[model samples]
Target: MTPELLLLSADRVGVLVFALSGGIAAVRNDMDLFGVIVLAFLPAVGGGTLRDLILDAPVFWLEDTVSLWLALLGGLLAFFFTRFLEDFKPLRWADAVGLALFAVTGAAKAWGMGHGFIIIAIMGVMTASAGGLIRDVVANRDPLLLKEDIYATAALAGAAVYAGLVYAGLDERIAFGLGMLAAFILRALAIVFKLSLPRARP
Candidate 1:
């Protein structure tokens, strides 16, 4: 596949997964359908929207309605099927997948658009994470940004790997795959091992 199509596919997968996680978080917060859907959309699209706006690219969701509908479906599924998922032990693992995919996709897109490595890395973190931050605030929980959650760090570490590989002239797919794997593995470890960054003093 062409790099553009590859990046688009990766971004779509990340968005869908993040939307599902957002919907799950909404259910956990006792939000209704509307709330869940909103949360899902915000998490799924917010990062890319922000990135596109900053880069003067067409806002992605405005150009494609599929992402919107998918987010809606994810939210609805979470709302209706939360009980089925409540007892599942792999929820954290699923979230890690979303995080890793989003980070790699964001970095790949930025690099494809001719952004510098630093900007690409920042965009990677943003694409992977800004949605969940919005969800937490909207749900009246302390945002992960305010806590020692393994959230942004997971994205940053993944982004660094992506940037480094790109700088090293690796094949695009190999780089992207490795970057995504790194992020996912780190995030899963963080969840399973209770890994977290140390808190800062005010």
Candidate 2:
């Protein structure tokens, strides 16, 4: 496969994983199927959609319907395979992978749009966190942005790492790989070790 196609595939995989997470959250909250689907769609596409809108770029999923269908398929798979996954709990891993992939894609897209490094970092955070924000809102839970979790911080860290690599004249492929790896590794560590950023006292 072409390098561009491979990158696109990675991004799509992230979308699927995040979409499944949304659907799983819905099921755990006892939401109906429609609610589940909506949650899945939002978490999968929300960040990308927001980034595209902000950039005044064509919506990413509008040009290709594969993303939408993938989100649907992910939700369905999560719904039907819930019992099996419940035994081992795959959502954490899925979420880590998705966050890493989406953060890289988001920053790349922003850079492509001629945004500066800081703006690209913001886009990366938006792209990675939008889905979870939408899911939490739909499920009537406070989004991580409103809480103490290190969610967006993780995304920002990944984006900053990518920008640093690029600034250092690293190849795009290597930069993307390292940045994505950083996000996944950091997030997985956080989940596994219960590492969280400090919360400020009021």
The clash count of every prediction, one per candidate, is 0, 1
lDDT for model 2: 0.83
The TM-score leader among the candidates is 2
Q: Could you tell me the TM-score of candidate 2?
A: 0.90
Q: lDDT, candidate 2, residue 91?
A: 62
On lDDT, the candidate that comes out on top is 2
Candidate 2 structure quality by residue, lDDT tens digits, 1-202: 9868876877778788888878888888888888878888998998899999989989989987899999998788777876675565676677777898889889988877778899989988999998688789879986766576567777888888888898788997899889888888888778878778887888
Candidate 1 segments whose C-alpha is farther than 4 A from its true place? 1-13
Model 2 ranges with Cα > 4 A deviation: 1-9
Candidate 2 residue-wise lDDT at 155: 87
State the RMSD for candidate 2: 2.0
Against the hidden reference, what TM-scores do the models get?
0.87, 0.90
